[model samples]
Target: MSSPNGASEKQSEQSEAISSRKWFARGARAAISIPAFILTAAFVGYAGLARETGLTLLETLAMTGFIWALPSVVVLTGALSSGMGIVPAGIAVALASVRLMPMTMALMPIIKVQGKTKNWQLLIASHFVAVTAWVYAMKHLPELPREARLPFFVGFGSSISTFVFVLTGIAYLLVERLPDVVAGALFLLTPVYFLCSLWGAARLNADKAAMVAGLVLGPVFFISLPGLDLLWTGLMGGTLAYLATRIWRRGLS
Candidate 1:
């Protein structure tokens, strides 16, 4: 009963759906990696922090699901524990999350499918542009068809985010039994994992230079300018690396 054009459209829709589902499954499987485990462990530490800050079960769960970034969650918790006002706490959390903006910017072009991918879809995908997901996407997305990249990243990010969210609730209940030192150490895992992952995955000399510069500058800034240490370290280290790499390239040329 359907016209030829209608049948072709239906068939094309079905094919697109099948491709998305297949890539989604593959992305979910890819989520079972060391970075995922490190992220989950980081959430375990967040659970303890949430409990110590007097957050209720519902609040803890909500923060885990909504904020979804350990550093931002930590900033919010720290602000609340210190009796900071809501507006200030929000600003602090936003600042902490600002680091993800560059990651999202780097990833958007990789996953975007020219005219076919919608801006709204990319917007949704940007929410999952954490360090772990960004690294995985950068490494794997090139291998996938352009159309599959967006769904694949969304699937991986959603699955990993959900997995951590559930584990955070369970960890919250068990956090009381964990030693303070152990919980703090658990929170440290993610940054260590992040640095190692970037170092290993980096393909360019500039990337390595930035890492080295950051490491060397981090402690110096922490001691001399504790309040703005992170800001200074990132700014100075990244600029230094960029200039150094450019100079080196020019000299070679």
Candidate 2:
């Protein structure tokens, strides 16, 4: 027969496990929302684009599953289609994906448990830290228990990722049936959502400043330095915003 302490510990473990499952289920259900739908729509456009770019269905699905970011997919597909070699295409994809690093960083503190959350868990969770999932987490995590946050995010992220993956295949098969205008419009939805989300979620004036600076410089750089426009825009715009913020703070003090 088990001792009373052993029984009590076993009961506690079971309760914790049940609670984790409940949170996971809640997150999966939450995946059926506007942002997730927007992500799905973006993948529809990605599917069509992939087809047009001569990628096989398998390749399209592989990219969706592995990359999981619309911008990275676009950059990789664009580079490959333009006859850029694998090395250059990979570099372009890496550059496009670098923007997500901040999102992952912002989320770490929110979901991390002081002693309970393991590094391996975080390493896995970080892979799912894309735009839609990060935005959802920011909106909902504070209301959740710290222990529940990681499971909830993994559930939400995995659910939406799978949902998009399936739809991307369907869209790929159906792209020939979709009109060019419709496909193009669908493909543009994600970036629009992305911009709106950033503006809405920005906590600091400096964040907004960087965005505005990027907007103003984007067109100018596109015309003058099309090849490295994005890189230059991000570097210059972010630097300008940082300097401005510092100057404003110094003046206030």
Would you estimate the TM-scores of all the predictions? 0.89, 0.85
Residue 66 of model 1, lDDT score: 83
Cα-based lDDT for every prediction:
0.84, 0.86
Best by TM-score: 1
Candidate 2 clashing pairs, residues 3+ apart or interchain: none
The worst-scoring run of ten residues by lDDT in candidate 2 lies at: 174-183
Stretches of model 1 off by over 4 angstroms after superposition: 1-10, 223-228
lDDT tens string, model 1, 1-253?
A: 4686998898999999999999988888889988899899888888887887898878989887887777778888788779999788887787678668767877888899888888898988888888788888887898888989998999899999999999989998876756878976886788788888888767679889988998999899989986567778888998899899988988745
What's model 2's TM-score?
A: 0.85
For candidate 2, write residues 57-161 as lDDT tens digits.
Answer: 999999899988888888888887899998888887887787777778879999999988899999988888888888778768878989999989988998999
> Residue 137 lDDT in model 2?
88
Which residue runs does candidate 2 get wrong by more than 4 Å?
1-6, 204-206, 217-253
Cα-lDDT of candidate 2: 0.86
